[model samples]
Target: MRSDVRDRIERAVDLMSTRMADEDAPPSLDELAGAAAFSKFHFHRVFRIVTGETCAQALARLRLARGTNALQRRERSVTDAAFLAGYGSSQSFAKALKMQTGKTASELRNEPHILARLVERLAHVEMAGGEAGPRLLAIEIARFDPFEIVAVRTEALYPDVAGTFSALASALGGTQGVTAIIGRAHDDLEGGVDGRPVFDCGFRLRAGDAAVPAGAEAMTVAGGEHLRARHIGSYRALPGTVDIIYRMILGRSDLILADRPTVFHYVDDPGETAEASLRTDIHVPICRIASPKEKESK
Candidate 1:
């Protein structure tokens, strides 16, 4: 895509994200085109190219996501989740939820059926509706001490993050100080600036005299409690694993999401690993919400 054209599309998508975040809905077609600075007649064509979905389709997906999260995480009742999700009633919200995810409000609320439903949903979406071969996903929690990294940033999508890693590697001339290579997504592509996801391709700095390269910046990765999941197979499937993680998170009453970027630690060298054999460990920052009794005591 032409840089100018891409920039315009990103600007419009950014606006859409802004509307979605603030209002739990999307703006009208005229508003979208205005945000893109294009004629309404022509903007849709370009937007479809950039995002691969109509404005309504994309926004609806985002809306469903908000409802799902709110229903799961914010102590919202089903009715509240529906209203915040822009639905007229809880029944309508339940129907839409079933249509999009093949699960009910109660199932989503408690996840009594999380395992059976989530894995199936993950495979179908990640495989693009292909036959769902076996997939493995597991979540665990661990405490991380403060660590450092030498990293480079880009506005590239996750699939294209390899180039940034290559550039960082070449700049450093070798992995002398590196303990592990990790990827950090700084923004959601759907809600990111100009609709482009920002990512950091970084090497974990070992505890030693490892020097930071001239071009890359040194920073401390967060240290705290994290919910981690292991992903097996292609990097493209990582999003599916992420969906499962969020679903699990929503079902929990004792855990609330912490404000931090989810980080992926590369467990295998993709250069030498088969696509099906690739291993990645994903870390989601989190905190334990005190129980009601604990809160009452405070």
Candidate 2:
């Protein structure tokens, strides 16, 4: 696909995502197509071909994902969750939940482990659109010792990750010991859309003398070797960038993925920076296999 066409489709996807996050009602097909500057009919065909799901299917999945988060909240009743998810009634919400997750609403609420499994399953569901980007700018490998960090954890959506950084900055309070500002995703985009994802947004802490704030938690990033890539542009394009990286990782026989969550270091403040100029460094952990000759010698 042409890069221009791919970018247009991505713009449409971004619009749809913004609407879904902001309002209970999904945007009309005409609105989405218009956002892409395409005719409604042609947009429909291209959208499905590019995203692998119909527009309606994509909307429904997004709604169901949001509903899953609401249903899991202890403070919100099932009826309340259903309404918040834009469903007319609890019956309809329950039916949709079951259809998507193979579990009833009650089952999800009462069984915490079941709910966890459901969240994991949802996290793996790709937003059915957009081909992966053709390339990443520069890839590198780096190693480091475990580093201490002070951060605030939130259940904010992926789009809000940048928004949460300010709170972390405030918590840091111009401390001279602060290093790089980092954001780590505890769940994937699917999990984030479902509202169950946890993100630790904060800065790396240098040694000594700085006091940890009341609400912030201090933790360490496990020291290890990792595959790194620099992503430039909107955070919304991260999934595609990540997809390309994973593809590259899988294609190599001598590389082994580590059991670790991916880490993103923000190079620019999203709140102060335009989306088009944002920069983030992504790190994926890996273990390298020794060459056959080296293995034999060992």
Candidate 3:
């Protein structure tokens, strides 16, 4: 089979579209992977490579986005929204949502999920390997609902990051939390306007907080609406995804981009050797753009 990354990504997106058609009923991972003709083991990585998020994370975000839309614009119930998102139990979902978002689902529905506004600015920074010089990139809008993630986190920068991660992994001792090491990049794709690329490299815990790495933090993804997609391949592939989102906004209705931080949601362990290349889920928090008239009034 041809190893065309775009083709595989389109297929994965198609599968996601199909799954969202009926939130109450969704496709299994194996079945979904089959749609893209990807290996069950390697499919998750491929999906992440193309879309920048894992299959599970994308699905959950889609569900939450739907639910957020409903809550904000319509008279929707949390339970109904949860059920539609394929949640087995609302209580469990809500609990996880509160942790990631720093607010309950109901709270977001009632109030805006705001990040201190960022100037709609553009800048440049270097890549991780230090091979390339600074490149121009912008931090765009993103919005996502809370989801569960088991991660090892620390306040460290690159080069030293690997060692810090090793120490964190050792401290974890296979206890609870994330079972896999997932990298979450909350900074701009351009490494932000600053030279430092802020990151939280951690593994998903198995059960409890006991497995949390020393000096690492554990939190649930706040439940709410999210503007998300998959980013296939290395961290270098992120810029393309951002461009696509901007184009989508231009073509779609007057959905203005808002100041929501973006997230690089990892699908597989970067340390794991796989038949396929690396992959990650790219998510941004965005709100609808206001009309010219609406903007003027504001």
Candidate 4:
């Protein structure tokens, strides 16, 4: 496949995943096509060819998978789960569950062992290997001290970083003592793409450098431990990298997501380096494991 075509499909997949994860109603075919910048007919044909599933089928699978997770985690009642999963009623949700997994929602909810088995099954289904599987070069635990930065924010999607960064660079105007270039994603993609998500493109500032440009603001990145993964590729492939990280976290009981946004540290300048050789360190904030007693109480 052509690189441009692959990037378009990836963006479509990301949009689909976002909507499904948010438990929102599936988007219309036109919406998906528009997101990919393709005509509706061509987009449908290419999406099926690339993903091996039609748009509707992919959405259904994701909804059922997330519904299973919710049942296993005890996060919502059956009726509530049905609504969130885009099913009209508990009866319809149960029927779909049985068709997909050969088990009813009540059975999975009432039986701890069965729920565990279902969780394991759903994990494999969710992270099934694909052509654009994650290519993370390394993973590490790192600590960052609080640091200030001046950023220009925008409500754009991935692969559109150049414009946002350019705006920030123009704002800085040869300011001295820059530490690093960073991209911060402020929205949870898993929750549906409703309005545009916010992205902050900026440079880390030196200590005591309090000069803030007009139309820009200074903010502090909190100090804490984070799970960092190094991704070596084009910015277009970052979604695949993030998917892998989420799968890793799901497989481990010791890690829980923190309430902070994910950060990307660009280690190489794109203008000087080829896209294939670019490196980005993605940091996801995480919390330590909970005790078994604490788990039981919850």
Question: Candidates' lDDT values, in order?
Answer: 0.67, 0.69, 0.50, 0.69
What are the clashing pairs of model 2?
Answer: 51-128, 51-129
Off by over 4 Å in 3: 1-166, 174-182, 246-253, 289-298
Order of the predicted models by lDDT, top scorer first: 4, 2, 1, 3
Candidate 1: residue pairs that collide? none
Residue 208's C-alpha lDDT in candidate 1?
72
Number of clashes found in candidate 2: 2
Which residue runs of candidate 4 sit more than 4 Å off their true CA positions? Answer: 1-135, 188-192, 290-298
Q: What CA RMSD would candidate 3 show?
A: 19.8
For TM-score, candidate 3 versus 4, the one ahead is 4
lDDT of 4 by residue, 1-298 (tens): 3445557767777777677777477776667877877544235434554555545566777777667777866768888878778889989989988987787888778887877776555433221323424445688778898777888877776667688787777777754666788887665322223434467788887777657888888877766878899888888887567656654553466775565667889998787899999999988776778879988999
Worst 10 residues of 1 by lDDT: 123-132
Off by over 4 Å in 1: 1-137, 189-193, 296-298
Candidate 1 all-Cα RMSD: 17.2
Per-residue alpha-carbon lDDT of candidate 3 for residues 1-298, written as tens digits (9 for 90 to 100): 1224446556756666556745455566557657766444334433544454545555656555544444444466777766665666778657656654666776666564331110000001111111112322333344445555545554344334566566676777642355545555444333321234456666655555544444777756443444566655654555556546544542345443333334555575557745256655655444565688998998
What's the lDDT for candidate 2? 0.69
Write model 2 residue lDDT over 108-183, tens digit each, in one string: 8889777876655543324343443476769988877877788888877675765566666676676366678777
